[model samples]
Target: MSSLYLLHKPYRMLSQFTDSEGRATLADVIDVPGVYAAGRLDYDSEGLLLLSDDGALIHRIAHPRHKQPKTYWVQLEGQMDESALKALRSGINLKDGPTRPAKARLMTPPALAPREPAIDPKRHPSTCWLELTISEGRNRQVRRMTAHVGFPTLRLIRASIGAWQLGDLQPGEWRRETLHAPRPAKSAKRSGKPTATRPRRHS
Candidate 1:
């Protein structure tokens, strides 16, 4: 069994435990000794971050090859429309490479807490939020993707990673859960009737 922690990382905090200049990091808030961040969230972004003591588990969850979906609520600079959504779903070319197709849709106003220091209102006059779900976790991919489509991201909040959701976990808070839990058996029927009327005779 491995130890897994879900941390709601705060803005401006470094992803790693150690920082040369004594910057705020997981070490500052989380006292766990052995656990380490499975993936990284940039200092400027805030949201769900997973940490684990198991290296293999970390790779499986964070590595792009696994194609684990990560969903983010992004506040962009202008009102987004169907054309923008289509472009996002199609793909966006970045400096490193072209991003893979993603699930992009306009975000219905999230119920999450407001970010401290708030977004710059002057830079973003008519802003609209969008929900972007991507499997590839490139460096600053969400920010870059929105920028590529001409709507610079005003703010970004990761809503979920894999099966875990941020929920009401405030910034700098964390929760622990098992990495692998046994799946519950599915019900035999959906409409309260067995699919097979009776057991067939062996023939």
Candidate 2:
């Protein structure tokens, strides 16, 4: 048997279980021993982060060779246009390297909780919303990409990874489940049985 946990990692929480500094880490929320985050989400970023006690599962989720698609709901600092979207979809060059092509589209913001430090409406900066799916994970890749296209990301919330979704889990919440293999990856969330939700966890 395997232990898999899907956590809605809150903003400002470190992806690792421990930190030299007293800042919040996964230890603050997760009590499941031996299960580690399969991939990382930046402290400034929020949303679904998968953890598992199984090493093979971790590799499958985190390794670039696996090419698991991660979907994000992004709010940007300027109006979005077709040209910018085309650059995102065609793979723009970044400091790290030229990125692989990705899926990007204009979107209405989804119902999400306000960040601890909400974007001030007083500034009244024009903004746009985009939903992007990319198979490659790089350090702050989405944020950098948006900025390269001239619409700096104001907020980044990863909504899904492959078939697993954040669903209705609020910040610092998690669910445990067993995933069976061999299903169609693209359609799993839409067609699979309802995922069992667990109770909220507190630090």
Candidate 2, residue 6: lDDT: 89
184: Cα error in model 1, Å: 16
Q: RMSD of candidate 1 to the true fold?
A: 11.2
The local distance difference test score of each candidate is 0.82, 0.88
Q: Write the per-residue lDDT of candidate 1 for residues 1-203, one digit (tens) a residue.
A: 56678888888898999999978888877777888888899998999998888998898898878888999999998888888799889987799988889999886778876788887778667999899999988888999899888898888999998777887778877777754443446742332211211211111
lDDT of 2 by residue, 1-203 (tens): 45578899998989999999888999888888888899999999999999998899899888999999999999999789999999999999999899999999999878987789898866746888999999999999999999999998888999999988998888898998876553567765553344455756664
In lDDT terms, how accurate is model 2?
Answer: 0.88
Query: Candidate 2: misplaced stretches above 4 Å?
Result: 181-197, 201-203
**What 10-residue stretch in candidate 2 is worst by lDDT?**
188-197
Question: How large is the C-alpha RMSD of every model relative to the true structure?
Answer: 11.2, 4.1
TM-score of each: 0.85, 0.90
